[model samples]
Target: MSSTWMTTRAWLLMLPLLAIMIAVIGWPMADTVRLSFTDAKLVGLGGRFVGFDNYVKMLTSGNFQRALYATTWFAVVSVTAEMVIGVLAALLLNQRFYGRAVLRALLILPWALPTVVNATLWRLIYNPEYGALNAALTQIGLLDSYRSWLGEPGTAMTALILADCWKNFPLVALIALAALQAVPRDITSAALVDGAGPFARFRFVVLPYLAGPLMVALVLRTIEAFKVFDIIWVMTRGGPANSTRTLSILVYQEAFSFQRAGSGASLALVVTLIVTVLAVGYGLLVRRAAGSAA
Candidate 1:
């Protein structure tokens, strides 16, 4: 009887959180799935259930295909760059040095800035006239003239990826650095005593400590990159001939701009599915790595 009472109390304590999750996440997701099967508009009440029409339309559309490709490319490039740069930065910061705390704090400033602010800042930097990037390149004799970085199809996606990497790499660096801190110092010292070079030590000793956290960071950053909207929206609005249009931007344009909520919901679900698959793959990789280490 006492155990039953405790169980009931525990459930009662969880009731408010359960109610909030249901109200916020569960209901909206259910409604979205329901709406995806219909011809719902942005500002409509009733709609006919045209089963699989939206999904079929999205799958058959070239524009949606392009968006998927762009989104995948953005996620892949940005996350890879972030992981590489972040691990390097984390390794650098991990060494004993003067002003390390100050430098570490300063390093986070880019990621600490709001996404809109970072996007706007990068947009201005990439501006054709009187932009810092152009001015620097011209002064350094690397460019004869200011180029429209975000206005060119070839450079728009690359520019966005660079800006995103700048803003997000520090997050991975922080994770990697924390993991590095937990590494067994005696093992690393033993490796050093055996005359292992810096690269060798990192590859064999330090990397094992970082593998788990880096995978988690990769999973998180990949999801964030896949659904990237604000930076692209503010910087290019997926312009330069729609070359930068990602799945999220496509969904936004389809639902709000074109007022095709049903199709938009369907596309959103597709993006979710893709992210979920990627996450699951990463999870399996993490598990395998952990098992191998054990």
Candidate 2:
């Protein structure tokens, strides 16, 4: 009876949050779906009753294709690198150290800093004439002349990936480290006592324990990475011939820069759909993984 009463109280407490979610999130999604069907303007009146024309134009547009490609590449590569580096960092942090607490706190700086500031710092680091990266490369005899990292089409996307990985991997590392700590000591010790190699033990025990948290991290990161804008905008503005242009950047260019509100909004909703699919897929994957683990 006490447990039943506590459950009832918990549901009552959650009612307000459920209401807020419906009002804020659900209503806006419904509106976006509605608006996508109509011809709307940025600052003017509604143009016409165009059903699916905006979406069709967006799908066929060359710029939108390029943006989709860029966004996909960025999400895949950056998230993969972040997961690998994060797991390694987590392993290292899980071990005992002379100044473990201080190191852990300091490592979070990248994750905690404002995205705009991170972009500014990275932009300066990539500057051709007087940036630190160029100076260091020259000093190391890798290059005879200073060259712009962000100004080159081939390297712009790669450079952005590196910057994003640096900023975000710390978050994954911290979460993984926490999960690693929760791993039982006896099981690991038994594996070591049985003469298992470090890699073997990690493969069999540690990885299984870490899998859930890692997947959660991957899903969250992928969603955010897919929609990234601020850092890219501040750093490169999707310039150097639109080489680094992503879906979200395309939305900005279309809506504000080009003043094509209906087309941009339509394009934006497609991105939203892609992200929603990713999120739903992740949810299903996570649920299956949890069940298997259980």
Candidate 3:
């Protein structure tokens, strides 16, 4: 077949998908961009164009600043913890054991659960009254009484972080485990014969194999963490003085809860911009890592 004909046939096959994407994603995105520049409300006619007023206001607001800080903190801490715990879990599971298969299957449960379901489960576990966590801590002499895990500013963010990590670490573990499988047994055996310690084996022998996959996991988790919403919403609703308010939550409140569609759209766009920059930055890092590995 001619190259031009092949190209034409491919485009013809993709036409339906392209049209659906334009209708579903492209139109909404364009509408949102238009809405961001207006003074629109959730229940009114199209508001007048405000020409960056919404963006300027949102960008300068104290609430935006606080939300940004909370989001960054959550993303950094949760992703970091997930990566560490996941790699450790992957390493452990990589070893031959009697029930390694069972453990590996069970490791997927947390990641497999729906986010809302996981959040609800964690909420009950952290419940101040008759919650598993409080009961366990009290029995262990760790606490004098039950404490509200999601109710206080001091502990709300930390509690959210812990829940987020639990739900996400399994994904990282799975990725790492898959990468670990690709490492040649002979290479690992040679490293062991060379008298390398466990840490040295991982660092010099196994790590180079794991690096690329782990970077991919890192990028995925970081982006998800940055835009975290449903879990936090179901758990804390950004409550206890908005202590757990992330960028996504802030956007939700601004757009839906407060009925300021224009401002909310602007905030959402800002968030999209931030996420885009992060994705682009991570893409560069991943490329660099791949280049170095090559």
Candidate 4:
């Protein structure tokens, strides 16, 4: 077949999918953009156009600022912890040992669990009255009394972070483990023969192979972390004085709970913009890492 015919046929094959995407994603996004410019309610005739009023109000609001800070902190800390724990777990699992296969198979459990289920499990564990965590801590004499973990601002975010890490680190580990498999055994053996210590070997030899894949993992995790909603919502509902309120949670509260569709759409777009910037930045980093690896 001629090249033009092949291209035409490919476009024809993709036309249905493209139409579906436009219907499912494109139309809603365009409508959101329209709604964002008005002062619309969730259930009413669309309100009058308000220009950039919603954007200005949201940007200047203290609530938005706090939510942004909380979201940023959650994303940065959770992603960092996940990456570190994942790499360590990957390294440990990569070794030869009995029952390694069983353990490796078990690593999928947390990641495989539904987000709401995982959040609920953690919520029960953090329950002040009869929580596993509090019970264990008190039994070990680490605490005089069971404390409300999710009820305190000081510890709420940390608790959520830990839960998030548990659910997500497995994904990073799987990615890292796959990358580790590609590292040449001969190179590691040579490094060992050269008396390269574990840290030195990992830093100099293993890390180069892991970098590209880990970068991809990092980008995925970071974006997910930034927009986290369901887990936090299920666990805390951005409670303890909104200490755990993320951008997504804020958007939900504005759009649904408060029924301010216009401002909610504006807030959602702002979040989309932030996520887009992060994705672009991470994409650049991924390219750089790939170029370096090449």
- Per lDDT, the best of the predicted structures is 4
- Candidate 2 lDDT by residue in tens digits, 142-246: 989998899999899999999999999999998899889978999999999998998999998898889888889999999999999999999999988999999
Evaluated at residue 126, the lDDT of candidate 4 is: 98
When 3 and 4 are scored with lDDT, the better candidate is 4
Off by over 4 Å in 1: none
The 0-to-1 C-alpha lDDT of every candidate, in the order given, reads 0.93, 0.91, 0.96, 0.97
Which pairs clash (backbone N, Cα, C closer than 3 Å) in model 4? none
The worst-scoring run of ten residues by lDDT in candidate 4 lies at: 39-48
| Global Cα lDDT for candidate 1 | 0.93
By lDDT, the candidates rank as: 4, 3, 1, 2
- Of the candidates numbered 1 and 2, which has the greater TM-score value? 1
* Tens-digit per-residue lDDT, 1-294, candidate 3: 999999999999999999999999999999999999999999989999999999889889999999999999999999999999999999999999899999999999999999999999999999999899999999999999889989989999999999999999999999999999999999999999999999999999999999999999999999999999999999999989999999999999999999999999999999999999999999999999898888
Error of 4 at 49 (Å): 0.6
Instruction: Pick out the ten consecutive residues of candidate 2 with the lowest summed lDDT.
Output: 31-40
Better of 1 and 3 by TM-score: 3
lDDT score, residue 249, model 2? Answer: 95
lDDT (Cα, tens digit) per residue for candidate 1, span 206-252: 99889988988998998889889999999999999999999999999
C-alpha RMSD for every candidate: 1.6, 3.2, 1.3, 1.3
